[model samples]
Target chain A: MSEVTAPMAGKVIDVKVNVGDTVSEDDELIILEAMKMEMPLVAPTSGTVKEIKCKKGDSVGADDVLVVIE
Target chain B: MLDMVMTTGVVHLTVGNLIMWLIAFFFIYLAITKNYEPLLLVPIGFGILIVNLPLTYLMQEGEGLLWKFYHYGLEWEVIPPLIFLGLGALTDFGPMIANPKTLILGAGAQFGVYVAFFGALILGFKIPEACSIGIIGGADGPTTIFTTVHLAPHLLGATAVAAYSYMSLVPIIQPPIMRLLTTEKERKIKMRQLRPVSKKEKILFPLVTVMVICLIVPASAPLMAMFMLGNLFKECGVVKRLSDAASNELMNIVTILLGISVGATMSAEHFLKPEVILVFIMGLIAFAFSTAAGILLAKFMNLFFKEKINPLIGSAGVSAVPMAARVSQVVGSKADPKNYLLMHAMGPNVAGVIGTVVAAGVFIALAG
Candidate 1:
């Protein structure tokens, strides 16, 4: 399993995928809002979604694990 | 002995002086307690308090402390340009470079400036004074002061204060107008992310801007040249020290002198007039109109572009820097919490600075 980390400090504004969902590489997985801009975090590799460590309206720090896929 | 004691400054204080003190205290209160532009209003409030103290001579023509600061810094047109230098160093032009069309929105925001000019004229102000008063709509403090110094020196205090005050009020003033002009669907429109800007493009931007802007409006050279130069210092990667000094140390030093000198200009004799009230009223109108014009222009542009532009970001063209842009983010997010417009709004926000400088240059060329 591999964890996807947030690129910057911001609030998690949306979670686009659920645990156990199959995803393709570069498919948008989460939307992080920081510096007043929304950044879409994408899947790093195609895999079945394992877990989502964040939720909508969650404040996150840089490098925080947002999702885990296997 | 009795006459000598009676001649002290306390004996000369009038009701006018007391009223001016109250006004000064009000500004101080806002700065300290309400957290409204404390850096500017605190010094400005103290300057007003001291200047109105019967006969402190703080603003005496040739010798008073603030008079010297005002004459050398403002009258000689030094502080505003230096302030521009600092702003340039502090600014990030990458967003603007990534999206050039926002520059048009910046220029479009000046709609309020011209509107106010004619508005002031109809109210019976002379051309020069009207020009100074009208520029307050730009929501740029230094530009307002620069133009006022050139076009209408007497109106400097009222115009400068109006500009700064309205700038702080951007959050409060822009929301209603943004909501009024844009539909909820328009506010929720998500813009494509800005492309990453190259270092070469960043370095080239200031050079090209100075050449084009100065050639067209030579009167803008003082502020524009310094502005571009500061940006170059920041972008070049070779002049870190110069950039740091310009944006930090020098900027802070100039701000203190600028705030106090601007405040000293607002003595009761000059500030307590019916026309001064009119200037304030017109300034508010200018800000509202500028905000509306920007949003309208964005909606108009949406008709042509295949990729839609979020109209809410357009109100940021008022040039209050991050504050106006933040207002766009706040208002846009309210429509849809997931919509983020701050980075996109920054394009028009920075562009508004350039637009105001150009407008000021045109005014100087025409009136000065």
Candidate 2:
């Protein structure tokens, strides 16, 4: 399983994928808002989404697991 | 009893002083309750309150406390540059270095500065006064104060307050203009991820920029040299303590002195004028025009580049630092939640600082 992590501390503004959704490398999976800017977090590898750990408006920290792709 | 009462400051208070007190209270209220530039507005509001009180001797030349802060700190041109030093240490030039084209947007935002200059002149202001007023569009407090000190010292208080106030209002002021100038499609444009910048490039950025910019505008050296030095201290990895001090301790100390001194300068006699009102009006115009100019420039640039740029980030070129960049991010995301424009916006945001400093140098060279 590949876990997607936030690059910075921010509030999750969008979760673009659900469990069982397949995503390609570099596909945007979530959007995090930090320092008043929205940052899109992308998938690291091609895989089926195994877990969605965060939802919209959830505050997250740097390196926090946001999603898991298997 | 009458003689003693006459000696008290109360006897000398006039409607003007009373009105100034109300203004000061309003500033304090905004800072404390609304959190608008509180670090600056609180001291500034108190300074206004104390100075407006007659016979306080707070601003009396050579003898008063705030007067000394104003004279040596500002008139000698010391504090603003020090503020620049702190800003440099605190800034991350990585985004800007990774994308040099944003520098043009920084320069493009200065369109409002020149536009305001002519606007002021058309309204009967002298060239020096007009120059001071024009720079408020740059949305940089230090640059506005520094430029006003050199070109029109008398307008310093009004111009400084205008610059800082407008800076705090950036989130509100910019979104409308950004929306007005950009189409929904343009706002939704997604930019490619910025390449990771190397430490070597980061270290060399301040060096190359200082040399190129200062050589072209020698008058900008005071602020620019210290600014570059601070950034060097941060990037060099050898002087973390110095970098820490510049961005933290020294910055806080000077900010206190600078804010209070600037605030005291707005004695009722100096501040309550028809022209002062006009300066505020012109300041708003400058800010709006600059925002429009930056967004328009980005749209204009998109015409040729294969990799399209989101025009919303263009409004970040006004140099309100993270605030203007944040406005761009917020506005851009409103168009598409999946789009992240914060880092991209920072390029022009930081570039706007350099652009404003250079523009101020040009003004000083021509009018000072």
Candidate number achieving the greatest lDDT relative to the actual structure: 2
Tens digit per residue, CA lDDT, model 1, B28-108: 999999898898999899988998987689899998999999999999999999999999998888878989989989889
Candidate with best DockQ: 2
| TM-score (0 to 1) of chain B for each candidate | 0.99, 0.99
- The regions of model 1 sitting more than 4 angstroms off are A1-70
- After TM-score superposition, the amount by which residue B34's alpha carbon in candidate 2 deviates from its true location, in angstroms, is 0.6
iRMS of each prediction? 6.9, 4.9
Q: Candidate 2 has what TM-score?
A: 0.90
**Model 2, stretches more than 4 Å misplaced?**
A1-33, A36-66
- Per candidate, native contacts kept equal 0.00, 0.15
TM-score of each: 0.88, 0.90
Give the least accurate 10-residue stretch of model 1 chain B, judged by summed lDDT. Answer: B332-341
